[model samples]
Target: MKRWVLTVLFLAVTMSSGLRADSSDQAAAHEIIRAQMQAFQTDDANVAFAFASPELQTKFGSPAVFMDMVKSGYAPVYRPRAVEFRDWVDSPGGPEQQVFVIGPDGRGYIAHYMMERQPDGSWRISGCYLEPLGEESV
Candidate 1:
């Protein structure tokens, strides 16, 4: 009985500490994302592109291509007026992702942006899902 009780107590403490640490890391990632968005809004593509993962950079081939896609594809929704970031979900079986709620002119979308931590300890936006809320699951 004593062994079981101690085991339970130890697990509880360890789990609680882990949860706290995860929450803090999540918060820091959000801050980094907000800054990235600000850079994009200011048309500083270089700064905005700095947040992406190396794999993404190679896949897209060049930072300019990446930025162009972002500007044209979601530009309507992500324009300075409609974009707002909220909610973060560490991707299931994947990296941490963020939710951006965008709306204006009678249209809107919930964008799920996947992010990765850069060498400098900043989160960079790497991938995104531009879709209506609850419309699809993957």
Candidate 2:
């Protein structure tokens, strides 16, 4: 009976620790996305580009190019009036978060953002795909 109690206590502590770590990672990922969005709002291309993954930065070549691409292609993301972050899904490739946003025109969009974890234990935006929320009330 004593051994059984000890086993249960150990499992409880281990499970709680794991949950805390997962929650911490989620918070960090959310912050990174929020910071990037703030940068976009301020037209701070360099700060926004810094939140991107190394691969994304390399692909864009420069912050100015990245900002131009975003302004042209992702207008809603570039200037979202409202944003509500949803679930964080774990995948073999990386973690993805779903964000509900209302653009300046009051149209709703679902922004799916993929996040990559750096070797130094920081999260970065690897990619994002936005879908229009058709007829959905914001």
Candidate 3:
């Protein structure tokens, strides 16, 4: 990905890296989300599909069609500028789900991301639940 693209995405992903993940690793995961978001924002189906997990890619197969749905369903409220991972829950068989607070709108977005431990012992994101943080009415 381009440096500016990485810069934009890295801002949000850097938060996830702290204590639990770290700046670099979080940046990488953020890149995935960034690519997906950029695809939706720009209406670029190919770019968006490229960011999907292998499972999703296999299931959908058509980037344009899937991008249409993503644009229609999720492009409205995804203005994420910052992200902070709050809690880490470990399940016996399930992937670790991280609760996060995302800023630029100050809302909650939960990432049920699968983590893979690298040979160096650091964790990188494998997959995640990407959802918009809905606002609560006062």
The candidate scoring highest on TM-score is 2
Query: Each model's C-alpha lDDT?
Result: 0.66, 0.90, 0.54
Displacement of the residue 20 alpha carbon in candidate 2, Å: 6.4
Candidate 1 per-residue lDDT over residues 1-138, each given as its tens digit:
999999999999997777667776677767766766777777787777776678777887776787788787866334634555565565773555445454443355667777677787766666776766442222
Ten-residue region with minimum lDDT total, candidate 2: 85-94
User: Would you list the clashing residue pairs of candidate 3?
Assistant: 17-22
Model 2 residue runs over 4 Å out of place are: 1-21
Q: Give one digit per residue, the lDDT tens place, for model 2 in 3-96.
A: 9999999999997777567887789888998999999999999999999999999999999999999999898889998899887777666788
Better of 1 and 2 by TM-score: 2
TM-score per candidate, chains pooled: 0.66, 0.82, 0.48
For candidate 3, what is the TM-score?
0.48
| Predicted structure with the largest lDDT when compared to the true one | 2
Q: Can you write out model 3's per-residue Cα lDDT over 1-138, one digit (the tens) per residue?
A: 699998978876775554355445555555555555555557677876766655566676798776665555443323444445444545563435353535344655564555554566544444555555577211
Pairs with steric clashes in candidate 2: none
